[model samples]
Target: MHDDMKNTTPDSHKKKRIVIGVSALLVAILAAGGAVAIYQHSASAQLAEAKSTCAQAADRLRVAQNKYSALINGDEYKSAVAVTDKQVEDGRVVTTLAKDSGDETPTMVACNVEDKTALERNTGLIDKNTTWYETHAKTIDADVKNVVKARDAKTLKDTQTALGRKITDAKKLYDASKDKVKDDKTRDALKKQMDAAGKLKDGKDVKKIKDAQAGLEKAMKTVNDSVKAKQDADKKAAEEKARQEAEAQAAAAAAQAQAQQQYVAPQQSYTPTYTVPQQSYTPAYTAPAAPQQSAPQYSAPAAPAQPATPSTPSTGGNTGSGPISGGHGCGSLCTSAPTDTYVR
Candidate 1:
């Protein structure tokens, strides 16, 4: 039994050695396979990124063309060309990098070739668009300024006609550039330029000229209405002043006639009047008559008796009758007596 175990052990050890060598060879083959798989995967990812970047660069070139067309129509061409040049440079870099890398599949190789060819063609198209836009922009600027400066209606109208001619020429040059571009990115860019030019031709663009025409028409109508209203007011005022003067003249004439009728002449005259007061009657008084005067008679008283005397002697003469006297007494007596006695 010991001898048989020893004889099989050497052959088994040889088989074991073969199995270990085969396992080591399998591990090394697996590691190599993994490394190859990782390298292929990394390379494929970079190629895809390169293609996507190249495509974006193509889109930028188209945008630069559209901006250039608008600038030409609006008289801004210098800035437009600068933008296009920068986009073209970026696209060329991406194309060169993609062409040199590993691409195992036939389809990947074809895609890479096609992308490089497209980039070379785009370079010429971009230059053409830039050159045309700049030339047209200069002409448009001068034409628009001349139209605004014209002297009269006839001259201004003539200037506008010339501007229309320049716009048509620019539109032709823009169309020729569009035909050279083949890709979707280039075609889309050309379409935008066509649309902007169409707006200018139709007179639909927002511009200073259109606004100025509308303002002038409104001002002329206002001036005409104001002139007519002022003439009517002046005529009415003159008529009112003439009527007031006529009424004042008639009133002055009537007052003068009434004053003339009140005049009179002057004179002086005199008249007299007599007046007496009345009296009542009163009675007069009378005195009574005096008595008459008469004469008076007177009576005497009685006397007493006396004695007788005796005789004297006697004489003798004549005695006649008587007798004798006495004689003596006794004796004589006797003698006388005797003679007387005898005569008797």
Candidate 2:
């Protein structure tokens, strides 16, 4: 009985060893199968995530492309877009590799991050430019409208030149007529107007230029009127002076003709008359007694003396009347007589 027990115990020990070896083998197989299943699930999830990441990145790229299209086509912005396009292409290559290989590499992740960052930067630039343009749109439109108006109406330069010419002509006329202007106040007023016109500038407003032109024209007209009035006045004054001088000359001529009508001369021819007195004296018979006693009584008997006769004075005339007187015994025989003679 002791020998049979020993042999049975050895066999039982051998069976326990075999059973333990089989259980260990089955456990190892189950653990390996579970590990494979876990690995496959994890791999599928990573590929799905990679595909999602790639799709999101592609959407972002499409959005960036749309933004780039909307931005202003400038040299600087286009160059920046070109650089971003290269990054997007790199990201696409990484995404395709990740999707096909069902693997996510650090390199692919980095490419996606870089692509997104570049798209964000490009979009920011586009938004900045859009905001700036939008803010100043009204101001730019106003400027453009003004420029167009100026161009249509005779450009600002041409308008300025025409205005300058008008001013120059007005100045010349003013200078020519200033000396003839008689009124100081009017001349000064016109001068002030001209100065204002001269100072006109081609500013932004068209109304101001038109106003200046009108003012200059009015001033020129005023100057011309003043000059014409002065000339007329001078002409009238000259005519008046000439008429006065002619009247004075005619009066002097008439006075000289009236002084030749009064003259006088001396006369030479005269006759004179004279008168004699009406008295006579005579002697008696003294001559008869002297002859009777001639020889005997010649010495005794002397003849009586005769009486004296009066004489008459002659008058200073062509004919004279007077009485003649005689001496001794011829007093009575003398008679008064008148004398006549021609005087030349």
| CA lDDT scores, all candidates in order | 0.41, 0.52
Off by over 4 Å in 2: 1-155, 260-344
Model 1 has a clash total of: 8
Residues 140-236, candidate 2: write the lDDT tens digits. Answer: 3343333334343444555566677887887787677757975556666667776776676556455676678777778777777778788889988
lDDT at residue 272 of model 1 (Cα atoms): 18
Model 1, 125-234: lDDT tens digits are 44444444444444434433333222223334443444355445444533543433323344343345334434443342234333333332233223333333444555
Index of the highest-lDDT prediction:
2
- TM-score for candidate 2: 0.33
lDDT score, candidate 1: 0.41
